[model samples]
Target: MAHLIFSEDEQRELREAARAEFPGNPALAYVLENLAAEGIDLDRGRDWEDLRVEAGLPERNAEAPEVA
Candidate 1:
């Protein structure tokens, strides 16, 4: 089992980024659920947008579409 944590700043950034990138809340929640089930715990916090990417979900850049 593993653990996940994030600083306040990281949490804020990921939260905002997810809101901007994901089309809706369900999408974001889905990613979070999967991560949690995978032993990824948001102790202090977590980088949800990054986790979304790890979960093979779409992600957006800060100023543009994601670059592969």
Candidate 2:
């Protein structure tokens, strides 16, 4: 296994990207665990959406957006 280095800004970007991909708490937790194994700490509280908003990432809707 190889060690990877990420800057602060890069870490922030990675967190946001992960949040965008895994909107649900369970899915997000899975992602965090994988990241932790890689030595990157990206854990969120119980409420996943709340964490996303706190991180300045856009909130994900439970339902799909209505098409015009």
Candidate 3:
């Protein structure tokens, strides 16, 4: 499985910073390109709107039984 394993707090900060700074097309592209320059290859297919909605949520608080 090609699952992403981001540290929750770190990803939240990154997302928030991105939302704050990249409020337009070229700026957003620059941000993404800069991330890629640093070897952070994010999957484009991942729906960020969905991720943002869940970013404030704890991974353990889902309806599914917790995995240990």
Candidate 4:
């Protein structure tokens, strides 16, 4: 298995981008999930929460639409 690591700056950027391009194209999210399961680097180490911070991805509320 592999590991994923990311910096603060990278985290922030990823979150922004994700939210900016929300609806995340389910396909894209699926790809990331697949990569993660395989121990691959998806979003360059920026996982769900970090992806939001890095890509500026909107906060995903279980009761709301996912902006990633």
Per-candidate Cα RMSD to the true structure, in Å, reads 11.0, 13.5, 13.6, 13.5
lDDT of 2 by residue, 1-68 (tens): 34555766766677777766777776775676456445533342247677767899765566857545
Q: Model 1, 45-68: lDDT tens per residue? A: 658787887899756658766557
TM-score of candidate 4 to 2 decimals: 0.33
Per candidate, the number of residue pairs that clash is 0, 0, 0, 18
TM-score of 1: 0.37
* TM-scores for every candidate against the unseen true structure: 0.37, 0.37, 0.32, 0.33
Put down candidate 4 lDDT per residue, 4-68, tens digits, no spaces.
65455665555555545656486675554444344444445545686669888677678896444
Tell me the spans in candidate 4 whose CA falls farther than 4 Å from its real position.
23-68
Cα displacement (angstroms), candidate 1, residue 4, comes to 1.3
Q: Give the number of the best model, judged by lDDT.
A: 2
Q: What lDDT score goes with residue 51 in model 1? A: 84
Question: lDDT of candidate 1 vs native?
Answer: 0.62
Sort by lDDT, best first: what order? 2, 1, 3, 4
lDDT of 3: 0.59
Off by over 4 Å in 3: 1-5, 26-68
